[model samples]
Target: MQFTFALFAAAALLTPVYSNEITPMSRRETGIKLESCTTSQQAVVEAAVQRAASLAKAAADAAINGDASIFEDGKVTYNCGNGTTQSDCGGNGVLAYALSGNNKIVNCPSWYKIVPAIDDCGGTDQGLAMVHELSHMNEVYSPPTQDFAYKYNDLVQLPTEQAVLNADTYNLYAGAIDLGCQVGESKGVVLPDWMVTEIMNNNSK
Candidate 1:
């Protein structure tokens, strides 16, 4: 389910004036590449990779190709370095890094077969929580999209401190994917409202 906004005078009016957290020319040059992954890690990466590819293709079809969704299967690879600057399963500051060189989203935790730790609630799929970082990758080259996502994320998590707690990273990516679609909808791109609902639902999770 993808959402797109209608392009109109509202576009200029509704478009958010993003902040410095994102710069269109900015590039995330630092981070580790994922060369390999365990069965579990591979599953997670495969799911995210497929979804990302689908979204990227949708964006292109809608003509919103703002460089927000350019990732693909072949363009992506993995690195198995664990506890060495790159690794999911909570081994370092960042589990994965989506580099700007070729719009590659690196799966840092390629070594770990399973996610190391869960959230405070013992949630699954929360281990390699690189969704936020991947969002940053999409926004790194798209400043407006980043600003829009950050603001939307804050709004979504504002209802509870628990939601925002330790949410600095998580919310950003979720917001990017969510609001990116929402913004697209408002820009005249044809997307479904269900997509927006899914994004909202995911953000709450």
Candidate 2:
């Protein structure tokens, strides 16, 4: 049985959204109200918009066969200043974006991105990056049991306890990561232990 399961796992690794492209002023519809202001304010809005865009893409990509092109028109709108809009940043703070599914993805501070470069493409398991990120998306939309628990319990502090929620989801995430690493290895790409550690860490949490 163990050998058969391993063979099945090896096979799955090989395997691989309807969004409005032409919704006019969809920004307002989506509650994104952009405002023109100082350099800093504009920068915040732009950053928020971009973050939202990435989140939207990731969510859509998870549903598809990892194809990002499906979410071409899923733009992120920003609420400038004044805080009148739901997407507006507070007092020149970074902007916020909400998905059609009512999911929120925030833009980080400017200084943070500059310091280490968010998504700098570090560590090995480059192919796993997409899989890992997609796991995050799965957490959002079709959250497995553990992920669902993570929402209630602070996963950052007590990562290990999350295993109590549901073992199945945890296994799914782990399997996905392992498959990613295997796929990379098959293509002659070597992944560092650190990258593998990160995947394990995410699951434990």
Give the top-scoring candidate (lDDT).
Answer: 1
Measured against the true structure, the TM-scores of the candidates, in listed sequence, are 0.34, 0.28
**Candidate 1 residue-wise lDDT, 1-205, digit = tens:** 1233221111111112122232221111112234446656555554443333333333222333233233232333344343344434355544455454565555554323334433222121322243334434432323212222232334344333332222232333232343364534443333233434544554454
Candidate 2 stretches with Cα past 4 Å from truth are 1-31, 35-40, 63-117, 121-205
Superposed by TM-score, candidate 2 places the C-alpha of residue 138 at a distance from the truth, in angstroms, of 18
Q: For candidate 1, what is the TM-score?
A: 0.34
Tens-place lDDT digits, model 2, residues 5-121: 111111111121224442222333333344434566555444433333333332223322223321222232232333334334343432222232332233323222232112222
Q: Give the Cα-based TM-score of candidate 2 against the true structure.
A: 0.28
Local error of candidate 1 at residue 159 (angstroms): 16
